[model samples]
Target: LEVATPAVRREAKKNRRLKIVGARGNNLKNVTAEIPLGTFTAVTGVSGGGKSTFLIETLFKAASRRIMGSREHPADHDRIEGLEFLDKVIDIDQSPIGRTPRSNPATYTGAFTPIRDWFAGLPESKARGYQPGRFSFNVKGGRCEACQGDGVIKIEMHFLPDVYVTCDVCHGKRYNRETLDVLFKGKSIADVLDMTVEEGVDFFAAVPGVRDKLETLKQVGLGYIHVGQQATTLSGGEAQRIKLAKELSRKATGKTLYILDEPTTGLHFHDVAKLLEVLHELVDQGNTVVVIEHNLEVIKTADWVLDLGPEGGDGGGELVASGTPEDIIREKRSYTGQFLRELLERRPGGKREAAE
Candidate 1:
């Protein structure tokens, strides 16, 4: 079983609802709510429904205070005004970046370090291989001297906005020809990086260490993701999964309190399942995952649901319903309950609704 540290356990033991009385933050109604710990909690509402304001302005604020020493416990006690219950909150939000010629996925999750070191440890490396440091594009030695290992170059566009073109000398390979000649199982470093996570999974399945992590990326609907794809080039959703992969790699000790904001932003219908697996793993490890999501599939999986909208704008912040998916569906007043009910009705013969 994944175990949280004694301190985390103690804090969780004291876990209770977050009380917001007369919250002055944006779009936040005089909200009074309680968010339970240990179980997966999904915060749901319509657009501009104070979801962001509540999670970021309140829970995240409390956690930040504790971490930065800007605030301390025992201020307003526990009923409201941000409490000590939320100590670990990681907010993953949207970012604008698709792909960058100079960047790739390796630099984001920190997986590149060990892989480079692994090659450096090879017998060939000891005989003729350069040090791990030298193999890095960030350094010299085996790097592409012409492009400085970035594989691309920035071009100044005269009489127009600045632009960049692929490096002419390196041909966007980002490695010297000699280094490209070194083969790991008949695949060059550039060749391996050029492969997507799906292809890389089969290619490196027997390589050990790196394979399992790469597989997770593939299962998460990132099969098209290149090993060397720059993070700066990734969509927000892709970057979140990369972050999830790193999070799952940690030894499960339930004390972690991860906060994810609309993690399903860019996913297609099929891709969400893969994301769910990652979240389930974290919860099974004993950590508390709090997500701000509008997706029905996510809220349906919740052990307990916290719906915070009677309506948006000045109407939200008051708790409309809090219970299981079944219970919420029974409540005529719940907005999410009504929407989910419609989904249930559309299915033939009252068939059960599927998780998104």
Candidate 2:
């Protein structure tokens, strides 16, 4: 009798995948594909090519409802198997973390709370009978009373645009004098917020809890943004990176599936490189990362590529090619493959094996 070897058994185990068959939602025309687990996969196509309908509407939505018990309904599909391996699914999109000036990166990531606690534990803060609540700009005690912690007073001119002038009490600093007096290593809490993420990382280096979160912000290419920068001031890409950084700071479970839509929407070449590094790191940690991307830089680096096309709109939605980047280049019907051909040819020894 023929017996399977250890290598064959390992290969068989690795070949286990998430199978989606006869997915006919929106523009997706009877799509069927098997995506490997514990690998970085990219779903690429042109505008109106049904990438979102397939990945988000079908895959992510289905997974969220099944694994996460989400109330939202997924698009129509025949079957989605192999979800038993996953514990949860997270969709990281480019939505703003906050709508008001009161919301900032520190507050969104829960890092500000610990930072405030650290400030409250300071020797000066203890002598002054201050608590963690006193360090918050959202509250009354530590914040400037004149501007009500807004740092700027908005004067509404009905006929003309609103005029926003600096706060007279704190001079644009949100905190009052007493709160500012509580310093750690010669820098107050407000001062720390004013510093860039890179500066904050260095400033809080001795404090692991605060330093690690700040370091994540820097790692995700947000080193230039201030810790206390207004949430409204950030662009879509910046907000997404902030969210990415927040997620990165957490201890990830290996069974989690991360789905990102157009992660490289507004990223520059350098920033894209940083983003790719972080994404691959996630996959390295045994988590599956699926991205709906058009950037060749991102697509080429993926362990597996699922190219959906032939044309956009009515003519598209079929899976034209599915394999490694090199395998994609061989498919004539795939527009993404046509573009990737040039990239793959130019870079010597860039061919990677497709994830099973």
Q: Which candidate should be chosen as best, given TM-score against the real structure? A: 2
Compose the digit string of candidate 1's lDDT tens values, residues 216-252. 6766667788988865567889878877776676566
Candidate 2 per-residue C-alpha lDDT over 1-356 given as tens digits, one digit per residue, 9 for 90 to 100:
11111111011136558998888887889999978888888999988888899899999999999999998777889999999999989999999989766788998877798899999999898999999999999888999888888787888899997777778889878999989999899998888989999998898888888888888999999999999887877999999888888878878887888999999887788888889878877876668889999888788787778888777899888999998777898998888898888776766443233334
Q: Cα deviation of 67 in candidate 1 (Å)?
A: 3.7
Question: What are the runs in model 2 whose C-alpha is more than 4 Å off?
Answer: 1-13, 153-165, 350-356
Q: How accurate is candidate 2 locally (lDDT)?
A: 0.84
Q: Estimated TM-score per prediction? A: 0.82, 0.91
Task: For model 2, give the RMSD to the true fold.
Answer: 6.0
Candidate lDDT scores, in order, read 0.67, 0.84
TM-score quality measure for candidate 2? 0.91
Error of 2 at 252 (Å): 1.6
On lDDT, the candidate that comes out on top is 2
Q: State how far residue 147 of model 2 sits from its true place (Å).
A: 3.4
